[model samples]
Target: MNMASDHAHDRPHEPPSSGRRRFCQACIGGAAAITVGTVVYPIVAFLKLPVRLGESKPVQIPLDRLIPGQAYYADFHGQQVVVVMSESGPRVFNASCTHLGCNVVWDTAHSNFHCPCHGAVFSGEGQVVSGPVSAPLLEIPFEVKEGNLIIS
Candidate 1:
């Protein structure tokens, strides 16, 4: 019998070095992150309210805080919507620009909505005033009641 070989075989294996242990831990963490990102991101986005509506549900936005002659940006069904109070009344408009689907910001000085992309300009009522866009932003359906905006 080979006593030396037998004794060596019976000994417990030595632990991995610190560098190897760190590498293994990092690999495990990376794999876990990848799995979560691939699985969780889509699920969370789907569960939240979508920007677009298929079956319209009414969302009440309190208007007590809104000031006349000012514009308000709000989330409608997890999508961005803009509201402005004009001489006629409060109106809701899509926050996305007509050109390239870029977002528009309210220009108080101009009394219009300006798209940072392509320099497209729209009226506070969502009408296209100038720039590349030929069409105006689509108006979202909303009704005012008891100092609140009921949007669908």
Candidate 2:
């Protein structure tokens, strides 16, 4: 055989169909699409506005439902609030602890609010009784209309 013919026979020949090349290109494209989606999905989700759980309206509770020296809990403007019936009248306060914004639980046995996070305590009247808290519970404005206790 001639030198050119011998050289051609010695070298490996590429497949005429090019199927393997097409398959590799498709795989690279798919991987790029997946990588871009993984990076962009979280950003798109974060940019979307959060769905609010509750409405921004006034909260109302019947005055008769309040028992003396007992605590009543309610949700107001997406925040947990508490109402305590004192001897003088009804008092409303935010249930969040002043120290670390933890939810304060009503200790019925002690007739006070207790913070489970940091061992803070609050009086039934929303005063800081003891523990790490320096500020009292936040007081919410309310009005008594007819037989309903209206909290705004």
User: Looking at model 2, which ten-residue stretch has the lowest summed lDDT?
Assistant: 11-20
Model 1 per-residue lDDT tens digits across residues 40-115: 9999988997666443556677877677778988766667888888888888888988788888999998889999
Name the top TM-score candidate. 2
Q: lDDT tens digits, residues 24-135, model 2? A: 8899999999999999999999999988755887899999999987889899887999999888999999999999999899888888999999999999878889999899
For each candidate in the order shown, give its overall lDDT on alpha carbons: 0.84, 0.91
Which whole-number lDDT from 0 to 100 does residue 24 have in model 1?
92
Worst 10 residues of 1 by lDDT: 50-59
Q: How do the predictions measure up, each by TM-score?
A: 0.60, 0.67
lDDT of 1 at 45: 88
Clash pairs, model 1 backbone = none
